[model samples]
Target: MRIDGRARALIAADDRGLLYGDGLFETLRVRAGVCPLWDRHVARLRVGCRRLRLPPPAAGALERDRDALIAGAADAVLRITWTRGSGMRGYAPPLAATPRCVLALAPAPAIPVHWYARGIRVRFCDVRLARQPRLAGIKHLNRLEQVLARAEWRDAAIAEGLMLDTGGHVIGATAANVFAVIDDMLVTPRLDQAGVAGVGRAVLLDAFPKTRVRALRRTDLERASEVLLVSAVRGALPVRRLDARRLPVGPWAR
Candidate 1:
C-alpha cells in the first residue's frame, strides 16, 4: 500500500473519511500490468472530488502511484481511496484540508470461468437504497447500504443481489451496474438518484448505440429480453435468474 506517494499502512484516526465518510474511491481492473480503464477511473474520481468538495489528486501523481503498485504484475486489482485528511473536532471541514490518498494492489480473485459463460442467479434485496442525488453516481466511501443489502442473502448460488430505491425503481445490483434489453433497445437505469456509474457501464454505453438512460422499475426488468450486471472487475455477467424470473444468457452479454 502507498499513502500520499509513500509506502505506508496506517492512516490518521481523526481523518474525516473515518469520521464522516467524506471521501471517494475507485477500483480499477488491471491486466498485464496495465489498467485498460485508467482514464475512465480517473475521470470519475475527478467528478467525485468535485461533487464532494474535495481536491482531486494530480493525474501525474496518481499515475506514478499506480505504476509503482502494479510493478509489472501480470494482473491485479487496484483500489484508490481519497480522504479529506485529519481535521479538528467538528463537522465543518478545514479551510485547506489536504486530501490523503491510499493506493493498494491485490491479486485478482479467481472467479469461476463458468460464471462468465453461464448466467448467474440473483435475488432482490430487501434493503432499499436511499435517494441522494448529490452522492449518486459517485463511488463514495459510505457503502453501509450496500453492506446491508449484501448481507440480506448468504446463498452462494446467488451471485448478486438487485437493489431498488425507496421509490421502488431498480438502481442496479449490490456492487455492479444493471443493463437490460427491452424491446430490442438497450436500457440502463439513470444513476442521478442513486447507485454508482461503473467504468464498465460507461464502456458499454459508449459502445452500444441508442442505449437509453431512464428510470427503470421492477416490472421493466421482469419484461426485459436480456439482463447484464456490469462491473470494472468482472466485466459483464448475464443475469440468468432474478427473483424467480429466469432470464436467458443472451448473446450480447457474451
Candidate 2:
C-alpha cells in the first residue's frame, strides 16, 4: 500500500473519503507487470476527477506507481483510490485541498475456468439503487448500495447479483456491467441513470458496433437470449442462470 506516492500506510484522519466517502477508485488487472487496459481506466478516472471537482493524478506519477507495485506480482489487482484530502468539519470542501491518492495491490481472485465457458448463476438484488446522475458511471467511494445488495445473497451458488435502479430499470451486477442479446441485437443498460461505465463494457461496445446502450427492464433481461457480466479485473462471464431462468452461454462471451 502506498499513500500519495509514498510508502505510507497512514492517511489524514479528517480525509473526506474517510469522513464522508468523497472519493473515486479504479481497479485494474495487472498481468505480467502491466495494466493492459490502463489507458481506458485512466480515461474513466479523469472523467471521475472532473465530476468530483478534483485535480487528476499526473499520468507519469500514476504509471510510476503502477510499475512499483506490480514489479514482482505476475498477476494482481491494482486499486487506485483518490480522495478529497483532509477537510473542515462539514460537507463543503475546503477552498484549497490536496487530493490523496492511494495505490493498493492484492492477489487477483481465481475465477473458476468453467465460469468463462459454462457461465454462472445470478439473482436480482432486492436493494434498488438510488438515481444520482451526477455520480453515475463513476466508481465513487460511496458504495453502500452495492454493499447492501451484495449482502442480500450469501449462497455459493449465486456468483453475482443484479441490481436495478429505483425507477425499475436494470442497472448492472454488483461488481460488473450487464449486457444482453435480445432479438438478435446486443444492448446494455445506459449509465446516465445509474451504473458504472466499465472499461470491459466499453471495450465490448467498441468491438461490437451493433451494440446498443439503453434503459433495460427485468422483462428485457427475461427475454434476452443471452446475458453476460463484465468487469475490468474479471474479464467477461456468461450468465447461465438468472433466478429460475436458465440461459445459454453465447459465442460473444468468448
Candidate 3:
C-alpha cells in the first residue's frame, strides 16, 4: 500500500531527492502504536539537515504525518524522507528552500526469531566505500555502493555483507553498523571517515557505558572475538561467517 496523507500525493517528479538523490531519510520501527526511538530519529534528522544545508521541517507536523500513516498498523517500518524541495534546472540549490517531507509506513519484513538466536552469516563484499568525511555519518539517498554490495550474492545463507572503506578500515555492514568485542570492551568503527552512525549503535553505546568507539582495520575485524551488525530497524545481529572464515559465538553474541 502507498503512503496516505495530505502531502502524500504532492510529490513532484522534479523533486531533488527523486532527481538527484539530494536528500536524507530515516527508517524507524513502530511497535504497539508507539515509536521507541522517535527522539533519536528526530535528532539524527536534524543533524542530517544541518550537514546537507537543508531546512528542517516542523516536528509537530512531521509527527502528525507519521501518526496518520501508521494509524492502524500494529508493527511497521516508517520511512521519512526530506528533500531540498523543487528548484530550477541547475546544480545549485535554491535561494529560499521550503523543503519537502514525506512519511511512509509499511509492514515490516517477517524476520525469524531464530535468525538472531542462531546468528547470521556474512561475506566480505568487493564493494569499497568511498571516504567522504562530509557525508560520512548522515543517511543520505546516495546508496549505489550498498546496492552493488548487496548484489554480490543471491544466496539466502549469506544474510549480509561487511564493507570496508577505501583506507582498508572495516566501516560497517551493507545496511548496519559493526560492533566487536575485544578484551571485554565493545569497540565499534568510528564514523568520522565513513559509514552511517546507526541509531541502534547509538542506543547500545548509550546503554553500555563501557562501549568504545574507535577506528577499526581489516586485521582488527579478523581478530575480533565477537562481531555483530546493528541498525535502527533491526537491533543487534551476530555475524557467524565472514568470507571463508567462521566466527565462533562469544559472550557478546547475544
Give the per-residue lDDT of model 2 (tens digit) for 67-137.
Answer: 88899788999999999898889999988878999999999998999999799999999999999999999
| Candidate 1 lDDT | 0.93
lDDT of 3 by residue, 1-254 (tens): 22224744557888888888889999999987778899999999999999999999775878888777777778889888888978877788998987888787788877778768878888889999999999999999999999999999999988899999999999999999999987777899999988899999999989887888888888888888889999888888888787777887667866
What CA RMSD would candidate 3 show? 1.7
lDDT of 1 at 102: 93
Output the lDDT of residue 214, model 2: 90
Count of residue pairs whose backbone atoms collide, per candidate: 0, 0, 0
Q: Which 10-residue window of candidate 1 scores lowest in summed lDDT?
A: 245-254
TM-score between model 2 and native: 0.98
TM-score, per-candidate, Cα-based: 0.98, 0.98, 0.95
Give the Cα error of residue 220 in candidate 1, in Å: 0.9
Candidate models: Cα lDDT each: 0.93, 0.92, 0.86
Q: How well does candidate 2 match the true structure, expressed as C-alpha RMSD?
A: 0.9
Q: Candidates sorted by lDDT, descending order?
A: 1, 2, 3
Candidate 1's displacement at residue 211, Å, is 0.7
Instruction: Assess candidate 3 and give its lDDT.
Output: 0.86
